[model samples]
Target chain A: MAKKAFNPDIDAPEYKGKYSPYDIIKEGTIAVVVVALLTVVLAVLFSSPDEKAVTIKSWSNATPMDFAATAMTELDGSSGTATYGPPYNNAATGQQVGPLTLAKWMGINVNVNTANDFVVAPLSTLADQPALTSALTTFASASSSRRANWEANYSKGLSSGSFSNGVLQVAAANAGPLPEMLGALTAMARSGALDQALVTQKGFYTTDYTKPLLFMADGSFLANKAQVQHLSGDQWGMMNETGSYPGQAWLWLYTMWYQVPPFSTSWGANADALVWAFMMLLTLLLALTPWIPGLRSIPRKVKVYRLIWREHYKNM
Target chain B: MTTEIDRQWTTRLRKRVVETLPPDKLLPDTQPAYVASWIYVFGVTTLAALAIVILTGCVLAMKGPLWWHLSGTGHFVNSLHLWSVEIFFFAMVIHLWGKFFMAAWRGGRQLTWITGVVLFLTSVGAGFTGYVSQTNYDSQWISTQAKDGINATGGGAFFNVLNLGQMLMWHIVLLPLAAVALTAVHVIYVRIKGVVPPFEEGK
Candidate 1:
């Protein structure tokens, strides 16, 4: 019984011409051996990367000023993760792909209040500090606009601030209690208490580091490390791994869009949604190419299959 | 008991399965002579590498992140897993490229092509999750970076990349299951359809 062929214009007729000896089980066994040996050799030559996760303690201890500066941004609600709407909060309008704003439509699910999660709550965890406790209360008592003013004033003081013996020396005028509060918070970050305190999930399995990563991302410390490792988005980081280790090279086409015109320039803000949309469209086309007229004809027009079937054609 | 077995659903399913892919076609002593190219071997190569990936992954899973980071043998196993994944995708892509040129979708094999596409996409996803589940600096950077794209597409509501437990579970379990299932379906399609006939020139 012969089967009906697909579209006559493009699809080749069912092959009934020739047969030859082929031991599939033997072929498969050889392949397994060959591939196993290849991977083992590659692994031995170039092992994987495993740089340890950065803790808040390391960040503070190594660069106390960077931690303090980042803490100030978190307190003032001016950091990247603080304003990273949708999954985090409704800080800004979520991403839009032309008419569709999918991020906004889904709404906030992670519910990260950067000020409390990154700063105040960590300070609140300290065992017993009278001045820190009083500063928290004073800051909590102030109005939103007043707090903004105090934050601005402290930010001004940070420009000329100095630290020695784990104490920040920011000028304390209209800054209100921020000097006292940040002093305590910086000390907490250094003690590694801030890292644990930020893990506020009320569960025994508190392995999710969403809160801490968000806080870390808001600071330049992590980004600095990423730059050194050649993992920044603009550097085609999607296809990169730390050091010389091979990355997700399979993501080449997906990540290449970031380096091109609109993604690199005009549409930077909406590039994520658009690039995703574009890749999806391309994938759909690739999947449905058999049914597509011009695309299905490419194999015939290109004649690459001739090379693939050279021996058969040679006999013919 | 013989009569009961003859009337069983299991018997009917067995008949149907054998009918679809008989022993001869499933493990044939011969394929078409046109399947002589080196390009044809990558499909099996890919399958082999995928097996290595799973085996190494099982070893890594047994010990968990701490051991993989601190212990030397753990690092070697982790390396095997990573390199196997690299080879898996490498060979898979080559297979896809060869199939595309040969138009393996001809002769009612469109579903076969689609399955390969799905497998490729799923494998890429599995690779992505694996990167994010390392519980290392790579995980930290990749998760934070990938979250935006996921969030922008409104996928973050369910798939929170920042959550290590969630990402690790998906990496080790969910995505691998999907990829394996898709691979099974893809291979079954190949078996049922019989390896696609070579592109007949001047058809």
Candidate 2:
């Protein structure tokens, strides 16, 4: 077969009556300018980052007993996230399932023994202080039930408590060596010396103690309050901010899934697994949309693209 | 016989012209109309936001993560980068759903659709590593928590979340590269195929 002659003008039908390259460029430049201007306005007005930091010492000096009770509560299993199953610590009761079928496979891997990591370990560092060391040891050796009773009374007393001259005073009925022990712990935290104690064990240490460090931080009263302020976990949604600072408002969609029932109330690995599953489903749907029935036909139903290029269509 | 040969040549020429011209340049008889819609802007706007994110992110990487700790300008730049990411993901989600409603993946643009989906996933990974690199208390908590999840699902064996060194490498190197590459592929497909024409006129 012979080669056919090429005619650019004859083939380029779109250029017959449409806008030229320069015209398209001009329009595009305008669009870019408008977007850039809007971005600048938004940035200038909402220029804030969630960068607040709360240290152990800050809390120890400010809210002493809350710190002590937090330390003690970690020694108990009362901290909200203490028993949070899978990923953080291994508490079998913390695991969740739907009806049957491993519903979720992931389980606790962080494995934080709150009592040992938060309470006994930190106290061990202050062993040179005989009074604190002895009190911690006694508290450690006491029956679980006895310790629980004491903690319950102390925690209750805290509800009606007040701070005076840096000392936290509660009802005498809930008083004893516990308050003094707490005071010493508070001092240790304020001095910033407690971080090492909480992190490092008594003897030679080689293990990566990141888990213990996280546990201590999570179980800390200040950390809890900060998380609350930030609207973390179930109590709050993604839109709320801690203080006047802006948080991850972009996470509204991801966090919204958690607010609804079943997911909101689910426990342990199941909750995390469900979230992952929902995200996966969404991605897959977006990916395979061309093949899906109802979704694949929506472009025709709403026919607004015609309006965007209405002038061009009118001329055509 | 010569007239018949001329007609045959004319038919061949028309076929070649149709194949060589851009889809948008073809006559309405052969080119499908993309009946315009508001949803169309969502995808393009998302792409625009992502372009900003990549530009700002590159500047931030050049300055290094500690730049925020160094001076006021660096901190401002870091804040801008952070906000860019926040906006990028926000626009991305909107774009994803807009495409969903329009079923913009129909016709022969499946590759474009898949590339977009991959880009979204990679962006999430990039966002996560960005958080981890912050080295703040929130970073500390998310890293440890996410590590546990990753480990349970067997992702930990390869991606050690506890290794700040590894996390840093992934954040600055691996994930961003994947995101940019996937986004490029998505754009190429979109340009080559043009937008998928609207579904059949009535439904």
Candidate 3:
């Protein structure tokens, strides 16, 4: 084959000078050992965090009222997942980036009915509970307005309920079958059945935890735990670990934007879409830095490479 | 025989491969003197960390989640996996910074830089999924929080963060496959282009 012509603009500077002996295998071996040693040292110093997953049983046992109240919201179609639009349901308009409702366009692929999936369906599986069974049947047959009325007042009454002695006692009139339904659900949660129940509703493989996690998210259990660990969105939780161990430090640049004015304030529900879009745009800009005029010139203008190759420069 | 060689696709491929990278150039014994830099080591350091990460992850996967949570050896391997991943990202960031500051893309290596950036993005996905597949509170909380951001872009349509099976497959199989392949291409480009020379004085 003939030698190809080299264009100075895109070609590497043709090296006619003396080259230095370099053992790439030796260098690579040293790096592998050094990096592996560093990893072992870090791992020994700080073992990874494995905080016990918050099961529905644990949540219910700890804060029964929160469980009951959230269960009511799920029934009323007012919980976070209940109103979470697209991929879950159509209760609300999904997040939008300016004009593009990408989530809405994606549609309800998960098909979560918070009421059925979170509460009724799980409760329906419980055998030999006539009152609970009756509540499920009545709740199912009742008008949407009547069910909403029942769930609302029960939710309001849940504000003062005492969940002591493994019992939920609320004093809300017109509560109808809710006390029975929620009470049964709370017991189901406390027994650890709800966790399996929520997951089992999806499949036998038991892979997806979306139902249970969504239900738990509606309550304060998950967030409360997160708050103690400084793992909330406000705390740059995306870059956080459970304890003092290192986290996803690469995401700091990404999560930093949320703390500023736009994402934390006016953007509200659309904040996620906007932040995601902005990060993508920034990544594109970073990738294309070689083509961007001032960005590309920064390396030469700053002369950082001169310092990197100082030995060669000194010889020159 | 010479004419027959030209007609064979396999022979043509072999010729093309050798043409692009002859035996000596593919694994050179000498490099440009300007390649001497502490920063230049980071690329290999990142690669080393990734190897450890994969090794630890394979061990963890072999024993399953319950074993990792229960057995002391499993726990240590899990720690190794986590720390190795952290080191991988740490070294990757340093390498990226070093490459950027050195203008490594100068010698028609734009594809190298672009692949690296895409590799970084792929890595972020891999890391995010690893967190989501931990089967612990961190996974639970992260999935819930990340789902909103994910769904906002309809990423949840396919890559449901809450789906542990899906995330585990992606983390272990799909993303790693992509990352390793991209790393190969990136390194091949580096070898082909040679270490980029420093900018000409004052220009």
Off by over 4 Å in 1: A1-10, B1-8
The alpha-carbon deviation from the true structure for residue B20 of candidate 3, after best TM-score superposition, in angstroms, is 0.6
**Candidate 3 all-Cα RMSD:** 2.3
Is 1 or 3 the stronger prediction by DockQ?
Answer: 1
Per-model DockQ: 0.75, 0.14, 0.73
Q: Which digits, one per residue and each the tens of the lDDT, describe model 2 over residues B125-151?
A: 777777767655555555655654454
By DockQ, is 1 or 2 better? Answer: 1
Candidate 3's displacement at residue B5, Å, is 3.1
Local accuracy of candidate 3 as per-residue lDDT tens digits, A186-256: 99999999988998875676888888888899899899999999899999999999988778989998888
The clash count for each model shown is 0, 9, 0
Question: Better model by TM-score, 2 or 3?
Answer: 3
Q: Give the C-alpha miss distance for residue A97 in model 1, angstroms.
A: 0.6
TM-score of each: 0.96, 0.69, 0.96
Over A202-236, each residue of candidate 2 has an lDDT whose tens digit, in order, gives 45553243544454455455346656666555544
List runs of model 3 lying over 4 Å from the truth.
A1-12
True contacts kept of each: 0.77, 0.14, 0.76
Per-residue lDDT of A113 in model 1: 91
Ranking by DockQ: 1, 3, 2
- Which residue pairs does candidate 2 place in steric collision? A86-A107, A86-A108, A304-B36, A304-B37, A305-B35, A305-B36, A305-B37, A306-B35, A306-B36
